[model samples]
Target: MLKPGGILLLTTHGDITRQNLLPDEQQKFDAGELVVRGNVKEGHRMYTAYHPVKYMNTLFDHKVTVLKHKAGTRQSWGLEQDLWLLQKGNS
Candidate 1:
């Protein structure tokens, strides 16, 4: 459920390169052989999954119209991160 004229803002890691942990880094931070820290953990630089904008648009079609969409990378602390902003239609 949503309210008329209300805003719905959502964001996610944009690309595979912007998410996930690197192999060696994951190994160093692993609690076990098959475990890794959180996806945004420090030194993690791999993405295990990708949910491109096209997919998101398809998923939201008919259910919610897109008012605006912006995508890009964010740099800080020598790391690159993804960003997105999506809005629902005003009714």
Candidate 2:
């Protein structure tokens, strides 16, 4: 577990990254659900998953302090991600 008061910074695929997903996947994502793609046999980037903002926060729930949350602009290849800056809970 992250030490209490520890700062964690991370980026992940978010809504803006949904454009590349299929219709069903997009629907699931818009519904505040996680969406994943790629084959298991492929390399890391080839298999990816994204979480909805709502869902993402839920994963941490009351366990952390969200210092910042922002979505980046979509890239030329249609990739965009959300940034999260968090501080672990002291509890």
Candidate 3:
């Protein structure tokens, strides 16, 4: 559990998933309540989750105060990333 006023920083795949995924992947993302994908080429098949800005904000609404939310594409990778900074509430 987080102490009051503690800071939490999180990052996730952002809106770019919708733009960069293949048609089939996008279809699955649209249909699923929560979309998760596995990286097959990585030998250790790890799964990753993606979220839109609104959903990401909602996920933490009850626990913390959002200090910042940033979404943008990285120039080198050309992939969108969501960065969030949250301060834990006293509740």
Candidate 4:
């Protein structure tokens, strides 16, 4: 639940779909066959969803009034990420 003037912020990663992976990434996928196969990574979660910017718009369209959208690098992992601030729309 949110108040009328409350803010909602979301921070998430970029496209992680198979279509977004590069050729070099495909090679890494093949290279990891033996050592990393079927094994979980050190810090990564079990389940994750990689949504594109377009999908974000689709998901939040008409549901919220976007106040600000920003993209920047994460200092911890040095990975790029997206930040969205939105307010719930009136019914």
Colliding pairs, model 3: none
If scored against the real structure, what TM-score would every candidate get?
Answer: 0.47, 0.83, 0.73, 0.57
Score each candidate by Cα lDDT: 0.51, 0.84, 0.73, 0.59
Per residue, candidate 1 scores C-alpha lDDT tens digits across 2-73 of 675556776644443333546674443232222223456467764343345555666778767676666645
lDDT of 2: 0.84
**Model 1, residue 79: what's the lDDT?**
36
lDDT of 4 at 61: 88
Off by over 4 Å in 4: 15-45, 74-77
Error of 3 at 19 (Å): 2.6
- Rate residue 22 of model 4 by lDDT: 54
In the range 45-81, model 2's lDDT, one tens digit per residue, is 5678888898888887898988999886867886667
As a whole number from 0 to 100, the lDDT of residue 81 in candidate 1 is 34
* lDDT assessment of candidate 3: 0.73
User: Candidate 1 overall Cα lDDT vs. reference?
Assistant: 0.51
Locate the minimum summed-lDDT window of 10 residues in model 1: 28-37
Candidate achieving higher lDDT, 3 or 4:
3
Using lDDT as the measure, the top candidate is 2
